[model samples]
Target chain A: MTQKDKSILMIGCFDTKEENFNFLRQCIVSHGESVIAMNTGIFGSTSLFPVELESDLVAAEAGESIGDLRKRADRGHAVEIMGKGAGKLVSRLLTERKIKAVIGMGGGGGTYISLAAMEPLPIGFPKLCISTLASKDVTRQVGMKDILLMPSVVDVAGLNRISRLIMRNAAAALTGMAKVNLKTDEKSLGTIAISMFGNTTACVNECTKLLEAKGYEVMAFHANGLGGNAMETLIREDCFVGILDITTTELA
Target chain B: MTQKDKSILMIGCFDTKEENFNFLRQCIVSHGESVIAMNTGIFGSTSLFPVELESDLVAAEAGESIGDLRKRADRGHAVEIMGKGAGKLVSRLLTERKIKAVIGMGGGGGTYISLAAMEPLPIGFPKLCISTLASKDVTRQVGMKDILLMPSVVDVAGLNRISRLIMRNAAAALTGMAKVNLKTDEKSLGTIAISMFGNTTACVNECTKLLEAKGYEVMAFHANGLGGNAMETLIREDCFVGILDITTTELA
Candidate 1:
């Protein structure tokens, strides 16, 4: 896609970390890419863009807000409701092709909300997260996607030397990725998709080899949910010609 | 845990269906107040002893049979490695606490090496599966802890009607949930663990008010990986005084 078509979508609880968001937004603009920062904070605060969409805009579009939908006594309900709103907003941007790449930074709550937004994007659409929980097992957070996780060495409590360094590097990374042309020839090879589990490896391998020798390229995926989902995604993209699902074990 | 303390663990490869494993063993035996079954099949088959201990000797293990593992390989060093040998075998099982629960089942591959060996057990352990992909989504397969998914429905290909029905029901409903009686004088309110997705209404309202009135307790799970892990299996074991978690978002 052209640079103009490659819009970088920056999302997170920017109200809590306006300084870092500002820095990242500047980097995106400087790299010759446009940005749409989706602010997921519950209460409004100053934003880099006056026209930035807030959670209320998301709720309004969805026809609900955290307070309106959640019980006053339950904070978790509010967070979950807000996360839904954010996910909807992000999903819209992705569907409309307004966002070619997405980046977010946050702690536990914000990470939860941001990931909710990122999860709906197609695989390999350039998803990145700079989070305090990056060092931990993020399989749950990143799921089966190609989301890049950058460890925020310091707590995201506020802007600091560490925050600046991390955000700058993240911004640079996404900017470069967004600017690059990743178009591959669509007619190079007809692909076959296969699913296998640890128990059924031998069967799939034998089948894959047989297929390869016949001049068919076989793409194998683990039968785990993400693995299956990834293969389906590629299939949906029309990247594969046929499917020899030998090890369809994990789907069970 | 020590090796002696370690038990023979069984996991299901419910990628296809669950008949063969569930019916292999029958009759539930009591080890103290808990009931245990030997077979891992969930819907089609019925087991005499539903729970098995790690110490007891059993015949088959999920990822053990080399012949079966070979059949499912696709390509790459990782695929070959995962298909054969026991690379992440121990850790993967340990992460799920298989030695602690030892639940498994499948078909040709499912029965050839998946559930037979899991037969011999000391007592007071977990083992279950209801393959046929076990009727769609399988949060139940993982349950609260130490369970494996076995693929038996589609390709494992063999079995009668009774076997399939028994296996499905067994996998979905069987808990292997050991009931332990404790003597306690101290009484605390109960806690509810709620799972929330961005889309539910009833969960958000009922959970909040209930927790406040009873002052019993409330914990909200985000319906993502961590949230599901925290609420469903971990916190449910009385980790907290009480639970009121109603919002379940990511089950789909």
Candidate 2:
């Protein structure tokens, strides 16, 4: 038996942006990659292309039915349930190691659902969102995840000149990320983190040299706002065995 | 009695980054603007300059004593309390109409506190944050606010070649925003919201012309993810009389 090919998980509301998704699917296919299209649209599914995961199945994952959601006629509630459903489904696919990357495009609700779906995925996983809200304050949707947001300069309404160019670029980026092989050195001393600012650079550099000389690998993070946040997240992920918090100014 | 001059709000942990804040204050002063510095630092206050609102005062706003916080020695808990305290204090200052703009610079904790302080400010108000985490995911901190984040490429430690340049630019930007008077045209017949995409541009253009001919002001928002989200926000702020959701693709 042969191993199944890892697929790019494409998520969106197929009911509305069917034309745009179809073009995106073609772009992915042109790169010789398989796509697992998932429809999160509550109203209806698309007939333009085949969807591996349908809206009904996605809603079912959230313990709801499409009919019930439609009957409720609440867009906000529907968005929440659909987002939860897609998240669970994507999580399962990740656990099965069936997906190499995830890509989604949409306006407000689509962006929300896509972010929610990608939220559970591990760090460094290829997660891309082609969204209109890319340039906006997406602090709530992104929430510390390394989710790459591509601004849809125009709306993701149809495959016009602008949409075509952006969607193609987005497809290429995602495909490249999915195909790249990251090399890691297995033999290393336990990883140590050292925080540094311009003021503490000299001290951090000296520490790094001494640590390396003793066969201990040292990773330095800038004591900037983002650097401190990143280091904290990595620490929570157990990426470092020891931490030398040299510049703790971020604790202000 | 004369009315008090509107001052730009400067927020940071003065105990540590006192030098940086002092430089920024001087920069603002050079622009002929007054600054209201608020210290969120829990350890101690700065002797470099007068801070109108001190760390102790900020902590007290959160119903905690600076001495008790120091005794706890809990960094995360302190960040939360200090952020809340600064937020309340800033909110009161805003309500009192004492500030023209708000600006802050920091790494992690500073970024959090600064953002929390500016979160309650009105939309369209000038809010600037020079942060190390500017390039990182700050969704939780920024939320839906229009906070302009400037990247402190280097750690915001002391005055260095990099820090000086970036900090100076940030100061200039904030001062410029603070001094600028935005003009509003008050002679509009009621504002109407219209959603549009590339595919529906022609239709929307025609509709907009017809609406304008009927003496109604038409505002078209691209039906992309961000556009939809922004439109929803504006709608909630009562900026529109009616909405023509032509392209609802974001609901995907």
Candidate 3:
């Protein structure tokens, strides 16, 4: 088995989600995985938990000072600068092969900013958002990325019965996704890629069975924006030996 | 005496600072001044206190669906749209005469977003930010508005001994600022306005003493960007009977 660093990149408005995030951090740490806290909140210095990448540093990454930012007192500018900074920081971390996954927590503004930060990461990297807006159509937040939106059934305000359960489960999901390893051997059939959606699921299922029976490996991609983007990205890397297009809804 | 509503507009990223905000709310409420919670956190809903303005509504006011904004997952855009929305919302509230004062708390993004919301309020509206960046120069955050910033000496993470004290004091400050009955009558001398900074403080102070001796109500305005802007704004409204131009650094 190859060595995989279970280092998770956790980002949030530490200026806001301190308690919830602290719980998540503790849960993750107890499970034997290290977490890197990238704070997006620049309110003050009395952070509830220790942060490796403070908002000021993130602001600096975007070519601004936290003091100047406070002076500018522009919310939209803060979001943009932090987003750009997070992207740059995330990109650098990816290049250095430091983080195995990404997870964020926030309501609307926090969700948007953190997810925007995650937008630049390569596909198949585990990305998750425990949001109050998760049950709602999150296509706007997920976009074309493989970001997993877990609905936080309760408000992420104070520590409560439901919030603790939801947060612990989320922490587990990220760690599990990051730690799981599925090794492929050389003797397996060459991989064949297929696109499918609910409307054409039966046809795609039949095609997959037929391909597998013919001694070829098959993998199905959903026709949603995120799935289509994933398929295209994987295809660019020659991750498939052949392609069978079953649904064109993502294009049309 | 003119009637001024004691309804204070309290805005912040409640997603994390629930305990602190709740404490402030209770303090404000107990003091008999109604506090309006203008929520800046768009995360989940387990808010410890009630908010009059939700971030989703703020986003909608910015001309974007919350769902679409979530999908776009753009932080900077979130900040801009929210800022614009807060500006409009605050302006409407001011027009309707709904709020008497503004109070905000958060680290970076929260402070910026909240201050941006306070930008449209006129001079002497009593704007404040309980911020982490308080010790640093906040000319940018305060802008030209009459916004007062109280430093959150601790991180506004949770209700520790220190955080509790700062937040309570901040709450009291807002309530006090809002409820003060500073009834001015017609017998006072004509108001004299002067602008000055450290380089001209001694000169301005000396002049103020002389003016007080001469029976004029002398008010000195610091020549910082915000102060200069405020001086200009107040001057525009015929606030000064006589202008003593002590410093022109804002113009420079």
Model 1: lDDT of residue A237: 58
Residue B51 in candidate 2, Cα distance off native in Å? 47
Query: Which numbered prediction scores highest in TM-score against the true structure?
Result: 2
TM-score, each model?
0.46, 0.51, 0.42
Candidate 2: docking tier: incorrect
Root-mean-square deviation of each candidate, in angstroms? 17.3, 14.2, 19.3
Tens digits of lDDT, candidate 1, B68-145 = 333434223212232222213433444543344344454333432332333232112333442334323333223332
For candidate 1, what is the DockQ-based docking class?
incorrect
Q: Model 1 residue A157 lDDT?
A: 51
Q: Write the per-residue lDDT of candidate 1 for residues A1-252, one digit (tens) a residue.
A: 443675777777766778777877886676677888777776664546643676677656556664574336455665566677777887777656677778888877777777777767654355667765553555565554445555454456545333454565566555544543233112223667778888888998899889889987676666766567656655665667798776666656
Model 2 per-residue lDDT tens digits across residues B39-58: 99989889898889999999
Can you tell me which runs of candidate 2 are displaced by over 4 Å? A1-4, A182-190, A198-202, B1-252
Q: Pick the candidate with the highest lDDT.
A: 2
Q: How well is each residue in B67-100 modelled by candidate 3, as lDDT tens digits? A: 7766887777766677778878888887776777
Q: What clash count goes with each model? A: 100, 10, 28
